[model samples]
Target: MSSHAPPARTHLLIASLCLLGLLSTTGASLPYPILAPLFAGDVGNGLSAFLGLPPKLLLGIALMVNPLGLLIGSAVLGAVSDRLGRRRILLATAIGAAAGHALTAAALVAESYPLFLLARFVTGLLEGNGAIMRAMVVERVEGPLRNHALSWLNGAFHLGWLVGPLLAGFTVGVSITLPFTIAAGALLVGALLAASALERGTAAAKAGERWWRVARERHAFTLLRHAPLRTLFSVHFAYACGVAAFYEFFPLWLVDVGGYAVREIAFVNMGMCALMTGAALFAGRASSTEPRRRASIQAGLAALSILAVGFGSLGVGLAAIVLFGLPHAYYNATVQGWAADQFAGYGQGAVMGLLSTTFCLANIVMALAGGALALVDTRIVLVLGGALALWAALAMRNWSRRAVSVAAQAVELR
Candidate 1:
């Protein structure tokens, strides 16, 4: 019997998931690049003083909730996707994210710090969209397309970050509430579209199995035993912790230390977005035929960028932000693709969920550390972040060698 080719709609399905992933990330990150200014002023300050706290501490209180929610969401909802099907969980996530954003808008109007933080945390609990989208794309697409799809998804993530903060900056003075409202609307539409457009569970092996049972399966831990898998998890953990810590402190450094305006800050972020998007696009093009070399290049770029951040020369900070964002896009795509390759035959959703949970936990630890460190010294945070990135680079070096050998043998077999 001749093998049946995948349906033509596969590409369209993958692309739609990418767009949804973009929306999910943008909605989650919309607050980050502008949190200091948005919540540090008159209204926010009143709330801070009433709550008996410093402005940055108040911000940290709000910010800490997001990663905590993400950590929980990735672990719980991710497993939900494994049993409930990708479409159901993604749609539910969209609804949850939209509701969270709406709450943010309401909180902005009310100027309530506690409510605002609650909204952000609830929104964050819906962060499984990215992992679900990745699992969907890699599962549906084959060969080079799978690698390309992941790279493009990573690129889309940067695009969301690019759009979210820039748009938030434009609206901050006009109305901080406005950005939240807009984000809410966008997510609502995305959720609706995903529900109608995406397929669900046609080929699921244990469709009738309870979610908890599937969640406890041995395969999840089995995948972790693989060396490459462990390396990817390490890289995600270190890089996320470092980046979260640096970003937590970066804006304060710029305002209190650098004396830059909101627009200037936004422009600096744009530089990171540009480099990140560019690298992701470049890496995706190379993922299929040369997964190993691509991994090495990503690791090299990451290490260089981290070094640049720590060099501590005049104007180096500005240069470092751009450099730091450059390598992450590719590194994320390559590692995620590597994970997909490991579970090439079965249970993609479960594996993706397990990996995402690790990513979220790393962010949670990093955010907590970031909050604590900012109380001490922001400069120390940057230095520590750079060191972690360097460590991730070394780990990636080992993964690259293994990837290269795998790619070579696969090619030779052909």
Candidate 2:
């Protein structure tokens, strides 16, 4: 690690970065609580009808656009960050996100669906800062500190989910565009914090290397050639598929099946967030042994599958939401810890970007799929999501055991 700054300064910087993570997710989630009403023509003075598209289709398109942008942005900018530097890229992305959110607010007020979509796309493109931030945390810390930092970052995400919708649920009642405007202002503040507080890190690219060469060399696709990394990537992708489906459709299911109001849904989300936050903090102190981590991940997946099944009962559904938080937090922290280990000497930006890309791609697929399925029956989407998680857990367990056995045999031969 570089020379440590004063304790106070270091703490402040860590806090600011965590806040940035929180703010980023807050902005991203601000639209979800209100999307149903906004696009269904129930809110915003028939805005959905004015757009001349089916409400469900428009909702899917809107949901999908951000991830599509993220997919492209993380792939390109993540590689660029490795060539350039983390702090510089983070600052730029923060500023861009601020502008993008402002544009979205304007587009909403103007009742232009196209502009709104464009704004969301732009914001998502800049939102790849998350990859940079993750890389930064890994670069700055070591050992248990690194694990804690990762946990804190993940907690920030769930906390943002908690606060964003609650804020939207309340503010959206006053003005349909209020939440976006608030998000824009918050992002601007995050940009300022990042600019003033963040320190520069060593660039991943060799000195004098060309950008294209760096990009070509660090291509995430190339990582697949390494068997262990490939296994990790596959497991990450599979796990994300189920998570994406659950998040994309749960709100819709609650509204359609259980007759939840926006504020009520927000309250339930708060419970989920609380559980996630607790789990994240807990994971930071828990053992970081590989076996324990893998077991935690598997257990989380199994619990998630059960949660999906429980969605059929209202009381059970709410309980499941709360219960799912621990596994979610454990799975996230463990996977991230593993990824950090894999990319220790490699380009953090590029590798994390690839992971983010996997996540975004999953989101795009699940969002569209969930939307289509909702028209038929929203519960079906949840059931399918559960099945996917169960399958992924089984596959991951098998692969993990095989890896262990191979290692044991190799040790005996040596």
Best by TM-score: 2
Worst 10 residues of 2 by lDDT: 288-297
Worst 10 residues of 1 by lDDT: 1-10
Clashing pairs in 2: none
Model 2 CA RMSD to the hidden true structure, in angstroms: 3.1
TM-score of each candidate structure, all chains considered together: 0.82, 0.88
Name the candidate that leads on lDDT: 2
Q: Which stretches of candidate 2 lie over 4 Å from their true place?
A: 1-9, 42-51, 204-222, 286-288, 291-312
* lDDT (C-alpha) at residue 195 in model 1: 70
lDDT of model number 1: 0.70
Give the Cα-based TM-score of candidate 2 against the true structure: 0.88
**Which whole-number lDDT from 0 to 100 does residue 365 have in model 1?**
72
Q: Determine the backbone clash count of candidate 1.
A: 0
RMSD of each: 4.2, 3.1
lDDT of each residue in 292-363, candidate 2, tens digit only: 247446555644644554355877777776677777787777767777776656567767777777888778
